[model samples]
Target: MKLSDFELDVLQLFWQHGDCSAKQIHEWVCETKPSAYTTVKTIVDRLEDKGAIKRVGKDGRAFVFQTQISKDDLTPSILPSFVKRFFAGNASSLITHLIDDEKLSDDELEYLENYLAKKKKSKS
Candidate 1:
């Protein structure tokens, strides 16, 4: 399912925090940027409509929400389109850019190398 940036942001909170009320989400989002509670609520409502989140329970008067989708569920669907749009569908180019241009630590680079080795071994 397609999601707006704000919807994804809200869903991320659910994914990270497990279950949360709208008030909690609004407060967390406000730490980075100023936003009205109603704005956060609207985004939460939209996420529910998209089936990205579900109302799990209630805390006082507020409705608690949980993620209906995992990052694994969403990323595979989004990545191809993202790579196509930004890297002309060349995944190797995208990986090259990330490895060469981005600042990766020694451990991170080692992990990627090991992962690639395993992938190659699996293919053979």
Candidate 2:
């Protein structure tokens, strides 16, 4: 299930804050994007249609929504295409970019090393 940038932004709200009404989402979005209420509602409606979110109940006249899909659910589907596009379908290139170009704290680098070690150990 591919999502547009706008859809991802809206989904992030649900993931971060749990269930909320379109108006509530609009208010939060407006803080950054200056989007209109109807625009935000349209995105919410699209998300509901896509099964990323569902109508849980009503908040007064507006419908309340909760996320059906998770960040984890979307990442595996999105990452392969992203890697294919930018890294020539090589996942190692992506990991290399993260290690070299992206900022990683010492603890984070240690964690990644440990994770790789465990993965190697499992294979062995």
Candidate 3:
């Protein structure tokens, strides 16, 4: 199922906090982007409609919800479209962009180098 940015944000909260009520999710979200409680609740409801989350229990009169899907579940589906839109559908361009735009620490660079070497060795 497709999710809007707001829905994705809400889903991420579910992934981070496990099960949570809409009020709790709103509080967390408000730390970064101030939004109304109703607004957060609306996004949560939309996420439920998309089947990305399910109501697992309740807290008082409020429903407690958790993600039905993992972050991994959505990343593969979303990445190709993201690449197509921003990187012209070329993964190498995406890699180059990351390399150029982001700072890679020595350890991070070594890890990536090792990962690439392993990938190359597997292909050979």
Candidate 4:
């Protein structure tokens, strides 16, 4: 399911914090930037409509919600568009850019090496 940018932001919090009410999400969102409760609620509503989230319970007058989708689901759905838009669909170029431009710690590089080795072994 495609999610708007705002919807993705709200879903991020949902995934980060687990199940929470709209009021709880609003409070957390506002801590980063000023947004009215209703606006946040609207984003949450859209997420529900997209099947990314759903009402699971209630807290007082507020409805509590949880994610129906996952970050893994979101990543695969969005990755194609990202590759098309930014890398012109060339995965090698994307990897090159990331390896060259994006900072990687020693641990991260080692992890990637191990991951690649595992894939190589599986392919053989």
Best by lDDT: 2
- Candidate 4: tens digits of C-alpha lDDT, residues 1-124: 7777778889999989999999999999999889999999899988888888999988888899999988887898888888888999988888899999979999999999999999999999
TM-scores for candidates 1 onward, in order: 0.87, 0.88, 0.89, 0.85
Model 2 error, position 109 (Å): 1.8
The lDDT values for all models are 0.92, 0.94, 0.91, 0.90
Cα-based lDDT at residue 66, candidate 4: 92
Q: After superposition, how far is residue 20 of candidate 4 from its true place, in Å?
A: 0.8
List where candidate 4 sits over 4 angstroms from the true fold.
120-124
The alpha-carbon deviation from the true structure for residue 71 of candidate 3, after best TM-score superposition, in angstroms, is 1.1
TM-score: which is higher, 2 or 3? 3
TM-score order, best first, reads 3, 2, 1, 4
lDDT of 4: 0.90
- Candidate 3 lDDT at 77 equals 89
Question: 1 or 3: which has the higher lDDT?
Answer: 1
Pairs in clash, predicted candidate 2: none
How many backbone overlaps does candidate 2 show? 0
Off by over 4 Å in 1: none
What is candidate 4's TM-score against the reference? 0.85
Point to the candidate with the largest TM-score. Answer: 3
User: What is the C-alpha lDDT profile of model 2 across 8-44, one tens digit per residue?
Assistant: 9999999999999999999999989999899999999
At residue 8, candidate 1 shows an lDDT of 83
Instruction: Tell me the TM-score of model 1.
Output: 0.87
